[model samples]
Target: MDGRRNGRKASRRVGPPTNRRRRTGAAAPKDALVEAVRQSRAATTGSRVVELMARRALVVAARQLLRQHTDRCTKCGSTFVTHEPAFVHCHYCGRMHRVANASLLEQELFEIRMGLRLAS
Candidate 1:
């Protein structure tokens, strides 16, 4: 379009410029911080699902383990405990049975006597 707008004239620098140094590939602290934050978030988000599942499974297993006993209905003598709070209802005779938790020592002794240990 014009003599000044030519590629040769456009490539000319005004001066030597303030800094005569060139930035290396490993330069810039701000970029490094940004990359570190991105990587940390990615690592945590990826393993979050595994952490939640493990915590849920632990709580469920603890609940099951705490329910150490089931009563037998007086009328039918069936140990088939059911319902929300585990009110042992006899299917045969239609009766509700009362249950109680044994002492901590007794439970431990019983577990030892029965060779009961963690399944895992």
Candidate 2:
């Protein structure tokens, strides 16, 4: 036998292969939520409801990202915070913290979030 121990053939294992369909070699999505929204939009044809829902989902996602990214104030450790293009302001302590210029992706998300807020 070829490379078999003690001249014994390998036993045939009997069981379902573990996650054979799972994309082990495929590149993961940059943002799962964003990719999900894209898929949802793509799955539907021209429909006003779907378009509105997609926008709403994007706004909600951006808000969540902003919240996670700005958890507490640096100056006074306050949780009440707001963000602008250049800085983050702590509402509770009235302190301004300069934000090291956001990435292009971040800026786009912030713009989407702020646009929604400003529109309403």
Candidate 3:
């Protein structure tokens, strides 16, 4: 039996056997997944905060314009007022002033835009 006559050939393309240990009880993968979830939640919360801030800014601007248009308290002639639902209350005299309907504000804004266009 010549050595060349033996037919078993080692495959060079085969990878070496691994001595690496298998993962234990999915705990390591779970930690990575938990971190990913936490990061995604943080990103969403940041976006929500930005959205809330924009809405607050719009409300403040509208409130300022309304206060300017009605620049005096009819009861006490004082300008100090606080906004409530569909009304503005005088702080100095405990009087309630009825604001126009919300749609009326939209109409007023439209007329102001038209006036600016005509002016230009």
Q: Please give the lDDT score at residue 78 for candidate 2.
A: 86
**Model 3 quality (TM-score):** 0.26
Best by TM-score: 2
Order the candidate numbers by lDDT, best to worst. 2, 3, 1
Q: What is candidate 3's lDDT per residue for 5-118, written digit by digit as tens?
A: 248654444588778887767566888988887789666586544335588888866654443336677668998976544456688998766565545555446556658334
TM-scores for candidates 1 onward, in order:
0.20, 0.27, 0.26
Better of 1 and 3 by lDDT: 3
Query: Model 3: which ten-residue window has the lowest total lDDT?
Result: 60-69
lDDT of each: 0.55, 0.64, 0.62
TM-score ranking, high to low: 2, 3, 1
Off by over 4 Å in 2: 1-69, 102-120
Error of 3 at 40 (Å): 74
lDDT per residue for candidate 2 within 1-120, as digits (tens), equals 474767787666568766556557867676986777767854465445532558878876554343334668866888898766655768998876655545656655676787844533
Query: Which candidate gets the maximum lDDT versus the true structure?
Result: 2
Candidate 3 local distance difference test against the native: 0.62
For residue 65, what is the lDDT in candidate 1?
38
